[model samples]
Target: MLLKRIQPMAYHARRLYVELMFQVMGRALQAVSEVDETVRREARALPAGLLFEMMVMPDGPRLVVEHTGDGHFLYHGSQAPRAVDLSIQFKHIAHAFLVLSFREKTAVAFANDRMLVDGEISQAVRMTRVLNRLESFILPKLVAQRAVKEYPKELRLPEKLLSAARIYLRIVTHLFQTARTS
Candidate 1:
């Protein structure tokens, strides 16, 4: 009698977990679908020969979006994304690249620490370009959210370092141009 009672409780708990998961999934799906629509809209405006494949691994599912040929788009949502030239993994919803009110991709929790990138170097560069575009679009929102939080001064040093490097490059470029023209 005790074992039977325990079994029912365990089963109910599992069912509850599934239901909660679906609820979260519904929200995420909505977000991703919106992003898909935006991609489609943007595809219409892009110039030719800009072949793009976006593989996004969100927290719960992986989304592969490929824009093939003149404004054609294909997409799917699954735990196991189709093999492609590039894949981007997000560890959490916060890490996901939100596109047009939905996420383009999400990752499992541990993948962020693992930092796995499966693709050729050229593909990596392409991935960077794609991400750079997305970052420019959505990064301000993320920064604004974080701006309200109390971050240690030490944590921001890396950004300062990068800014300094950019300034140094600009100065060097000016010097080189002067040297060459003179």
Candidate 2:
């Protein structure tokens, strides 16, 4: 009985953590698109007005991104808009938490059947590249090594530090601005 009770509490905690991670990631993507040339190029490759979503199955936390006409991305928060062009859905919250926490890389999670992609393979590949680049910029080198297939060789330590600082600052500022408006 005690084990059952504890399990539910632990699961809820993990869910909340994953939800927060999604929020940060959504904002980080938006921030990177605005400030990173590589990300802007990637966004340009995607179809304008593309709506991409990442969520856990069965009504879990989600992040939606829209590719704008000017080669940028807009974070749409957790509420998915109608007609998502591509969707990556984790089979469960545990799978999402594993990938979000860097305990499991995205390719590994997909290979392990922890995720389902519901969109064009080519578009998904492009989005995956964008996410990998974003992770490289935002994560520590050590953690990024585990999260990405290959750490970007050209990203010098100084540049990485500066980019991370800018992205994080933007995320915080955007959050504050959103809160004020709300």
Candidate 3:
């Protein structure tokens, strides 16, 4: 009986963790693409209105984002009406959290089969690059190094800090807009 109770509580906590990560990651993706020309080019190469999602299993939070035209994307709620072009579905809440956890590499997660891709392979690769770029901006050197195969050494410290600040500010503004609209 105690085990059953603890299991549910743990699940809820992990679920909440995954959901919050998705929210921030979603906004950061959009914000980075807006600010980085290379990322913007990558985003533009994708189909216009193409929606991407990272989700946990049944009833868990889903982060949905759409590639609006002109190299920009907007985060769409999980309930958004548009069709999802590609989705990276985590096996479970803990699995999602583990892969997204600080200092955890997504490539390792993929190799470990923690995530499943439900769309085109090319798009997934492109999305991976976008996520890697965003992570480089937001995560610390130690943590970001583990997340991607390479952390660009060319990126100056000041530039990275500035980009992170801008990305965070944009994320907060986006969250405010999201909350107000919701």
Q: lDDT for model 2, on a 0 to 1 scale?
A: 0.91
| Candidate of highest TM-score | 2
lDDT of 3 by residue, 1-182 (tens): 89999999998888888878888888888888778887898878899988898888665789998988777888875665667889988877888877778545788888888889999989999889888888899998889888886788888899999999999999988889878988
Report the lDDT tens digits of candidate 2 across residue range 1-182.
89999999989999999999999999998999888898888779888999999999978999999998566888999885688999999999999999999999999999999999899988898899889999999988899999988889999999998999999998988899999999
Q: Where in model 2 is the C-alpha error above 4 Å?
A: none
lDDT of 3: 0.84
lDDT of 1 at 94: 32
- For each candidate in the order shown, give its overall lDDT on alpha carbons: 0.39, 0.91, 0.84
In candidate 3, list every pair of residues with a backbone clash.
none
Model 2 is weakest, by summed lDDT over 10 consecutive residues, at 65-74
TM-score of each: 0.32, 0.97, 0.91
> Model 3 compared with the native: what TM-score?
0.91
Show how many residue pairs clash in every candidate, following the order shown. Answer: 7, 0, 0
Q: Give candidate 1's whole-model lDDT.
A: 0.39
Better of 2 and 3 by lDDT: 2
